[model samples]
Target: MPKQIKLNPLSIYIHIPFCVSKCAYCDFISHRVGDFEINGGVEAYFNSLKTEISLYSGLLEKSKVRSIYIGGGTPSSVDGKFIHNLIMQLKSLANFSDEIEITLEVNPGTLTEEKLNHYIASGINRISMGLQTTNDQLLHKIGRIHSTNDFMTSYEAIKRAGIENLSLDLMFGLPGQTIKDIENAIHLVGILKPKHVSAYSLKIEEGTPLSESYQKGSITLPDEQLERDMYHLLINGLAEKGIMQYELSNFSSASFESKHNLVYWENEAYLGLGVSAHSKLNNERFSNTSRIYDYSKLLSEGKLPIVEKEFIDTSEDLFESIMLGLRLNKGVSINKLNQKYNIDFNVKYANALENLLKQGLVILTEDILKLTIKGMDLSNQVFLQFMED
Candidate 1:
């Protein structure tokens, strides 16, 4: 019998930083095929990832691994058996508690049926596939490899594999996008009936081709009013399908909420391995080096690639906890606040909270504090107060 492990978060994240191609809008540290110098680079990448994973055995001891999230530029770009071997190594090193969540981020066009079965048989129960939009023109404009039809086939295959939990990623406010486009996307979502959905607005980040186009004024985005209308319609339309918004971006049906993400927003501690992964261990924050060569070099030399670590200070701790806690629909617990922080959380941010409350953005009660409808709409404004530290 498999040994029983405790039911806390000893979660691990493995980064597979290779992709078939880079999307125009993505700036993640993922290398396309022609970028690698070494002949056996995929082997080197896997070995480097395992070397990093081994460094944590001493740190985690026998803690129960509640979840494992294998995210990337695109995890499916790698061989599924390599992932299976990595999962096997993980199983031997630390015990996975019953109900451990293992998730892989996939691109719809990249996976094959045989590999999909290997992923399921290898113990990946949850799959998060990137399906940015149903509109083919928008997809082409964004330089995504997959069309809407490709996502459908991939979705059908996951069902055929007998894997149950699935997540579909959606984005809005693309350059030259309309509210009608978003509405059409929602109708497509209803037909798909995915168990979970994550919706994000397109942001123009530096070092991305999309940002370059925006800087050149070669593309025009929907106006702010239109963007907000799109978001509102997105929430209401998904609600019609019984997928309730659990976090700002994630919506889920009963028991389908993302366990690994909750590890983040709830401020629970977890270990992150591989390049560019971040970790919060016992109120301390640490991030790995972003460059793959640098990460590989350091691990090959028996050194940690950790670039930064900060111990949580008092005011910083309170604000961080509150900032993270309010992202949930469940809200923040005022009693837990007084217990954990040794100060009234309300008064520390009382003025700011009250100002937001008056704006019909945040709601406060005797025991709980949560974002109101208006607050969810203006969540960035609410979260900005916590960024002062």
Candidate 2:
């Protein structure tokens, strides 16, 4: 039998794979569903999720959950009752912290006042709404079902539901997006004053509709300089609004940082359930199969649906510790690395560190090592130097 290792203060992620319509830029595991499919598919999916949750009861019993995040193709698109049931089930199965943060991702088109109220009553304390761009033309071009007005309505409903911690997901560098478009979006974010904001640049993911259009020269994104300028604009604008940049793409007011995401960036253990979810526990990293039917069938047959698992070796763990830790503004602790790996970090990567420092990409203090402003932009270049052959 595998040794039972207690994972105290764990984080849980539940993936919901149904969306009313797929966004053009999306590459996540999600499917479009109609009313007929919603009736049967939603129930079947939730049943599989419950069975999967029970499979981890032994591990969960030994752990204390610190955060729970429900993410998806569009979690808010589902019937609110399903979400409520999932939360109630988790509450009954696990030992939750008194101050645990429960976040649910919402899309403007799918949210309703009643649904928001039901979420608030179900112990969900945080709401993350995807409002990629406020420009209706851009929204339609990107296959979003909702307009800026719809986002406003949903935002107001969430506030009226009495949920205080709210996050807005914004994007820049979309096809045909200009600086003015980004400025207008950030201006709206300032007006609403969400507790958190995630401003990400558009990446043309392979197999996505956006990528296909780019391949055919039908979609033209902003150039590299424009994207960088937009990022700087976002940083400066949000800073003036008292939303500090805590991560590369995330900003928040004081004490409003995302605790669930921090679990991943800090290299902490987390449990993931549902189709296409990923998990890291007991020095192992794994992910579930992306296919919903495959995931559900395996659970129905009394099996875990995980399709991939890797036991992280010592060197890989060290590399991940540095790579993930440096993504945060606080950076990594050199002393902790030295202690944990029993190797002098300064000596192990002396050449790489020296080159990075000379390039003004990183700073090494007495204890902590972190990326500089320029380094965060060229982070991939700096991180590549830490890779072990």
lDDT of 1 by residue, 316-382 (tens): 7777778888899888898998998787667777778778877888888899989987888888789
Question: TM-score of model 2 relative to the true fold?
Answer: 0.97
**lDDT tens digits by residue: candidate 2, 1-389:** 99976648899999999889999989999888574273698889999999999999988888889999999989988889889999898888888989899999989978877787779888999999999998899999888999999999989988888998999998999999999988898899889999999999988889998888899999898999999999999999999989999998999999999999999888889999999999999899999999988999999999999999999988998999999999999999999999988999999999999999999999999999999999999999999999988
TM-score of each: 0.95, 0.97
Best by TM-score, which number?
A: 2
TM-score of 1: 0.95
lDDT, candidate 1, equals 0.85
Question: What stretches of model 1 exceed 4 Å from their correct place?
Answer: 1-8, 386-389
lDDT of each structure? 0.85, 0.91
lDDT of 2 at 97: 89
